[model samples]
Target: MDVAEYTPQELARLQLGFIIREQPQQNADHSGTHASSRKRELQRGQQKARQEMLDDLGVEA
Candidate 1:
């Protein structure tokens, strides 16, 4: 049987195990990556958000 056929209990167990194994390796950055990298990321996110809002309002940025 495929792993996707696993029962809910089994799937939950697998997910919990994966999180436990990976959590410690996860990034703890308040921003993300290095300082310069984070600035670009924030800028991109802000620009995207503004564009989305403008699109909803039928306006161009």
Candidate 2:
């Protein structure tokens, strides 16, 4: 689906799904430190995207 056609709630849901999907696995061991850090960063970005979507909807976060 086109992002421009999504409602704020739909965008937020999509972002949340991304966050969930990208979450670091507890048993992840390859690239140990760097992978964990990168995962953390990506999760933070997903959270920010979700917040932005909520803000666009004028939701009091």
Candidate 3:
């Protein structure tokens, strides 16, 4: 199914999946700076997806 067919919960689940998939590997000894940057990126993506989902559902801020 297309994105337009997905419910808000489904959209959220998909966004969560994306964030999880994008997470840095546990075995990697990345510095705090890199880790924080990656985390910020994922958070931004989640926020954007949530906003889009809310918009699709005709929800107001």
User: What TM-score goes with each of the models?
Assistant: 0.44, 0.58, 0.55
Per-residue lDDT of model 3, residues 1-61, tens digit only: 7899997788776868766675667416765877778677777777787787799889996
Better of 2 and 3 by lDDT: 3
Among these predicted structures, which one has the highest lDDT?
A: 3
The 0-to-1 C-alpha lDDT of every candidate, in the order given, reads 0.59, 0.72, 0.74
Predictions ranked by lDDT, top down? 3, 2, 1
lDDT of 1 by residue, 1-61 (tens): 8997996655655655555455445545443457557455555655565566588789966
Q: Backbone clashes in each candidate structure, one number apiece?
A: 0, 0, 0
Off by over 4 Å in 1: 1-33
- Displacement of residue 34 (Cα, Å) in model 2 is 0.6
**Which digits, one per residue and each the tens of the lDDT, describe model 2 over residues 1-61?**
7889997767777766766675555425565777678777777877787787788889988
